[model samples]
Structure formats: C-alpha cells, structure tokens
Target chain A: MNVGIVIVSHSPLVAEGTAQMVRQMVGEEVRLAWCGGDPDGGLGTSVQAIIDAMESVWSDAGVAVLVDLGGAESNSEMAMEVIGEPRSARIRICNAPIVEGAVMAATEAAGGSSLATVVATAEELSPL
Target chain B: MSKTMTRLTSEDMKALIGAMQAAIAENAERLTALDQAIGDGDHGINMKRGFDAIAADADAICDKPTPQALSAAGMKLVMSVGGASGPLFGTLFMTLGKSLPEDFECGAFADAFAKAVDAVAARGKSSAGQKTMLDVLYPVSDALAAGKSVGEVAAVAAEAAEATVPMEAKRGRASFLGERSIGHMDPGSCSCSLLVNTIAAWISAKEHAA
Candidate 1:
C-alpha cells in the first residue's frame, strides 16, 4: 500500500475542502481520509472520527496526519493511542498548516516518499 | 477540622461532574468572548459540548472507580469536544484517571494531577506563561503539590487565569495573533480556572455535608 494522508480539522467543511485540494494535487492512488466536526455535527474534531479516518486510509507504507488546530492535534494523539503498536509507530502527526501541509504531504506520499520524508516535507512548509 | 477525606468516592466523582457541568454552562459565553479576541471563538461552545457529553454519561461514569470515572470522563471529552482544549483537557483528566491509585490520598491526588498537567504540557508542547490552559493548570498543580486546600488552590488557579489577560499568546491559534493577543484572557485558561473552581466548590460542599 502507498503512504496515506489524514486531515483533521475542527470544521467539517475545512477538512473536506482541504482534502479536495489534496486530491487535486496528488491525484488517485494516494489514499486520503479526513475527519472533522463533533459527533453532533458542530465544529470540533472527534477522536473516534479521526481514528476511523486513519483506519479507512490505512497503509502499510505508513500514514501522515495533518491537524488544523489544537484540539485536532491532541485528539489525533488520543486516536494514535487507541491505534497502538507498530502501526502507531508508522503514523506521524505533522506540525504544519493543515491545508498546505495536506497538499504537500499528499503529493510527497503520492511520489512514494518514506513516511519520514512525507512528514519532513510537510513540516518544511512551516517556514513558507 | 475533621480529617480530610482522602480517597474520592463515586459519590464525590458524581458531585464533581455535576459541579463542572454547571460551571461550564454558566461560563460558556465568557469563554467564547475571550476566544473571539485571539482565537476561533468556539472555546466556550466546544467546552459546553464536551461537558454536556460528560454530564450525559455521569451515571455510567459514577458507577466506576474514581480513577476509571475520571478516565471515562476524559474519553468522552476527547470524543465530543473539538479544538485544542478538547485533547489537552481530555488528556488531563485521562492521565489523572490512569495515574491515581484506587484509594488515593490527597498527596497522591496532587501527584496525579501534576502528572496530568505534565501530560497537557507535553501534548501542547507548551509551558507556563504560554497563554494557554497551562497558564492556569501549572500554578494550580504547584499549589496542590504544596499541600494547599482545594479552596486555596482554586484561588491560585483563578489568579493564574487572570494573569493570562496580559500575556501575548505563544502557542495555538492565539499565537497567530502575535502581540495582538495581549490584553485578552486566554479562553483555555479561563475554562481551566472554572473547572478548578468547580472542583474546589464540590470538595467544600462534600466536606460540609460530611
């Protein structure tokens, strides 16, 4: 499997919109999933929803999670805890702008970059 | 004074949840207003959603041991609340739940709370004076370590929360505001102080009842 990308945002629209941009950038074959909004459909990220997204796009080549805000990062961590093991080790939470990071990371993953390369590629965007 | 109730009971946990729910409900608007100054302006709404989940599950949570109850509450928050505070606060309670002993004493409770606070710091990659929830939680953890009463700890936490009003946010969305963040209270710190205050009030009421 190729590297996967997960976008976590507090707004469902933001997550979906970012994923749309990433899809346009990376094209098909780069598995991508997005989680946003609370269980009640309000603005907030959900741990279970994030975990579900990660699982949906699970890749043996590893996964990179880009979070939009504070709660998203923390919730993603909680999801990682639930995911556990070698798979958890394979996943990384990149500290990058969600929209740009998703685009860059998805492109890198599409190029079959290593998980670390994907994460580094996203983090490098921090200075931009 | 009678000996302090060391170990928290299920009843105490229920009371704490009740108090927290009430506090969050009361402060939601103020929290949102604070966030409007430097953040996305949803801290209060997100917190209310999280606490509402906890309140909904209060009966189930109160059926567990104190540690498990707290952990469960944290899980609910993590699942229900969004934004930075959700995970940070969720980890705080979850870590406290996981670290405390089954029959914990006050000192052990303090230790567990400190550990939870540390987890929050690590999770946020932040520390005191960062204009985040840590601004309130760190000092409150210290007061707890110093063996302060719950009321005194609440006072210290409130002061720390107030101290954030003058700070330029260094982390999270508020950091995006740069120097503009100064003069606005951090929404997370405000919420944290409310939680601490509610816990203090619950403990006081419990003591009075006993």
Candidate 2:
C-alpha cells in the first residue's frame, strides 16, 4: 500500500501551506486533506469532507491524519469513531509539529518506508 | 520577580546545550512513546538529530562568547534539522542570543527568554491552549515576565507542562485523539519544560556558585 497523508487545520492557508512544504519533501505520492477553514462554519462540515476523502484513499494504504486547533481536533475524533474497523486500522493521528511531522512522514513514506518509520521520523518534530 | 541577573559565559552556553542534549537522549524513549500515541513517534529521533548536530559543533560553539555560541547553535539546528521543531526552537535560541547581553545577567535573560518564547510562538503560529509546546512555554514565559526567578519559573513551567495532560489537544498529532488527547501531556510540551527547567537550573546553580 502507498501510504496516504491527511492534514487538518483551522485555516485553509496553514493546511495548504504545510501540504506544499511536505510535498516538496515527499513528492507526488502522498494524499493531503484539510479539515477546517470552512467559510460556512468551523470544522463542522470539514469532518465529513475528510471522512469522504479518507474513504477514497484507504485502498492505497493506511491514512495519516494531522489536525489544527480545538474544533478540528474534536471533529477528527468523531471521524475516527465513525470510520471504524479495517479503515481505521490504516489511519493514524499526528499532532506534534504538523508541518515538520508531515514533511518527515511524507519523506519516509515516499521512500517506501513503513508507517512506523514515517511516524517515528515525524514525531521528532514534537517539543517533548 | 526578585532582582537577579544571569551572567552567562561561554561555559554556561555549553552547559545549557549539554543539558538539552542529555535531556533529549535520556528521554528519547519516553518522548517517542508520547509521540507514538498521538503522533508519528519520532520526537526523540528528530531531537536527537538536532542535538547531536549541536553536540558535534560543541567545541566550535564553546569557542565563541556565550551569546555567539548560543546563536550559532540555534542557527545550526534551524539549517540542518529537517523538522518544524528545529526551526521553531532554533528561532528561540537565536532570539535569546540576540536579546542576551555579552555579560548575560539573570534579569536580562529572564526578559530575553520571554522574548524567545514569543519568537517560537510566531514561528510555529502557536499559543498555550493550542496544545503545542507553547502549552508549557507560555506559562514559563509569563512567569519570567512576572519577574519570577529562574528556579521559580522552572517549578511553574514544569507544573504547567505536566498540566498539559488531561487537556484536550488543540493542535498537533495528539489532536486526533480528541478526548483521548486530554489525558496525555504533549511530548513537545514535556520536552519544552525540560528545556526551560534546564536553563532555569543552570542560572540558579550559577548564582549559587557565584
């Protein structure tokens, strides 16, 4: 499976910006998703949007979810709960340094590395 | 809050750097565990990478005066480390280097350290409740701004860092955990507290020795 990447943020700008940076590190293979910055509301509709996106990408590989802000976070949790079982198994949530984590994870995934490897590399960006 | 100064020398910078290095190395597993739960589990790996780089240039950094050495170290981390924390943290130290005086005093460092926190926030676009490292960092900065001594800041920062546990993540990987994130402290916040405490301890020890 070719691992997928999802980035959720409070602002579309942040999500898109981080995606652009990670794309440079990982190239064309990774999938990107934004869960917030919806003009109509908060992360309300974005949750369904991400869930829909995840549904489409699961066949490729496990999906990695990165979120921004409180509402987006809560919404992501809802998505995870609803998207149960095998699909859920393929998904992981990364919160540390989003841009840094995404870039690291993408680079590792692009290199045909395992989720563990990418996740490990991505976590290095966290402050703790 | 009391009037004191942080008179750092080249030796002091080295010690602070050393403390950061040791903290990363020693806490690698714990850091990774925290990350793996909410993130990709490489907090230790990236920190090790950045700190290892810092250590490699230790002698060169130590050769310069305290502020210069600290600045160089920050620059090195930003340039070489390929993660968000690298640049964000690198900016922090660089800010400190810029704000700190040659004869670094505690009072000056406290003020400068607060500025350093601002730099990190600007770089990361993060704040205390956002559940990034700033969760710990903000409280510490506020303590310093309130004129708390290094030891005082250290205690408060450490407590604040620990308090991150049980708080739902407002940002980062743990954010996905939603409510689950509430029970766990952010690895970044955890490490940031270590950084703050290290600096505070260094300052306090220096004062005691003097």
Candidate 3:
C-alpha cells in the first residue's frame, strides 16, 4: 500500500496551494489532504483540522505530514495526542519545507513506497 | 512570612487560576507591544484567547481535582490557542497536571514543576537564556526547588523576565531578528512572570485573610 500525504500551513490558501502543487506533481494516485487556518479562519493552524486532514488521507502504509511554519509543526504534534496510539505511530511530520516536502513525499508515495521511505524522501529536502 | 503548603484545596487552585487569568488580561496590551518589536505581534491576543476559553469553563474546571483541572485547561490551550505557544504552555500545565500527586505538597510541586519546565524546553527545543519563557521558568524552578517562599519566587520570576531584555533571541520568530531582539523584553517571559506574580499575590492575600 502507498503512503498517504498531508500538507499543513498557517494560512488556508497556503495549505490549499501546497496541496494543489502536490496533486499536480504526483498525480491523483497518492491519497492526500490539507488543512490550515484558525477556528475562525484566521492566520493560524488548528489541531482539529490537522487531525481531520491526516485521517482523511490515512492509509495502512501510514501518512506523512508537511508543515509550513512553527505553529503548524507544534499543532501537528498536538494532533497526535488526540489521535492516540496505533494509527498515530505511523504518522510523521517531515522537517522539510511545506510545498517541496509535500510534492516530494507524494511523488515517493506515488511510487508505492513505504511510509518510512516516503517520509525520508521528503525530509531530505530540509534546509540546513 | 513564608508559607509551607501542605494541602492545596480546590478553592485555592480556582482562585489561583482566576488571578492568573486576570493578570494576563491586564497585561495583554503590554505583551502585544513587546512582541510587535521582535515577533508576529499576536502573543498577547493568543494568550488572552486561550485564557478566555479557559475562563468560560472555569466553574467546571475548578470543581475537579487540581491535576484534572490543570490538564483540562492545558488541553484547551493545545486545541484552541493555534500557535507555538499553545503547545508550549499546554505542555507546561499538562505535564504539571500529570506529574502532581493526589495530595499536594511543596516538595512534590517543586519536582513536578521542574519536570514540566523540562518538557517545555523539549517541546520548544530551546533552553534557558533563549529569550523565551524558559528564562523566567528556570529561575522560578530554582526558587521552588530551593524551597523559596511564593512571594520570593514571584520576585525571582519578575526579575528573570526583566533579565531577558539583555539577551539575544535564540528561538522562535524573534530569533530571526538576531541583534535587534537583544534590547526588548521577551513576551513569553513577561507572561510567565505575570502568572507567577499573580499566584504569589493570591497566596499572600489568602494568608493575610487567614
């Protein structure tokens, strides 16, 4: 089974735009979703939305998340607490840039790669 | 003059929470002004939003055991705050909630607080002298561990918050400013001190009343 991918950003438009790029680059085969914005659609990431996105694209092969900023990463980590064990063990947040990482992970997932492999492939794009 | 806390009642805990909430509200604008100089300028608004959410359910939260109430508030912040601080401060309270014993004691509180501060450092991946809340937290931890009075520790916290003004930012959005972040007080540190002072003031008030 192919790994799933999700993109997270602090802005609604940024999340959607990144997801768009990932979809266009990796084709429709890779399961994918994106979420962002605060509760009232302000410029902030929501842990609830992140959890929903990850579950929306969840696969037995696992899901890899790409986050745009600090809030996205921390809130994504908080999402794991809500998601609990078993299913959460397979979810990983790549430390790479949101857009590049989502595209790269999706590409790897498109090749039917394992979650570990997909996450690793995307993480390789992280800046020093 | 120093109080050795043996039994912390739910009533006292609720009052502490109330005082801390009010203190945050009072200094909201100050926090915003500080963050405006070095960060995205939403620290005050975000902190108030989380505290306001907590206040909305204060009655029920204060009715629970201290640990449960703290954990509930921490979870509220984690889910609702929507920023790096949400998780950071949430970890602080949640860890304290999880670590504390059923019957509260000063020594136990000191240990739990130390562990909570360590969790915050891990969550932020930043340590003391980083011009973050850890700056104030570390001093408060030290004072608590040393069995300092709440009033004394509160003073330490205030001084620690002020001490951050001379340090350059090494974490968070402020870090990007490098040298420019040196002269300003850290917003997180100030908020941490606010909570400490509020708790101190509340305890003193209760002691005087008794």
Q: What's the lDDT of the predicted structure labeled candidate 2?
A: 0.71
Worst 10 residues of 1 chain A by lDDT: A68-77
Candidate 1, residues B1-210, lDDT tens digits: the string is 123456666777777888899899899999999888899888889899899999999999999988898899998888788667778888999999999988767788888989999999998889887898998888998898888887899899899999998999899889998999999989999999898888788778777887
List pairs with backbone clashes in candidate 3: none
Q: Mark the regions of model 2 whose C-alpha exceeds 4 Å error after superposition.
A: A1-128, B1-6
Off by over 4 Å in 1: B1-5
True lDDT of residue B191, candidate 3: 91
The root-mean-square deviation over C-alpha atoms between each candidate and the true structure, in angstroms, is: 2.0, 14.9, 1.5
lDDT for B68 in candidate 3 is 86
Clashes of each: 3, 23, 0
Q: Model 2, DockQ value?
A: 0.03
Q: List the residue pairs that clash in candidate 1.
A: A70-B84, A71-B83, A71-B84
Worst 10 residues of 3 chain A by lDDT: A38-47
| lDDT, candidate 2, at B100 | 82
Better candidate number, 2 or 3, judged by lDDT = 3
Deviation in angstroms for B7 in model 1?
A: 3.0
How much RMSD separates candidate 2 from the native structure? Answer: 14.9
lDDT of each residue in A66-96, candidate 2, tens digit only: 6655445444554564588766776887765
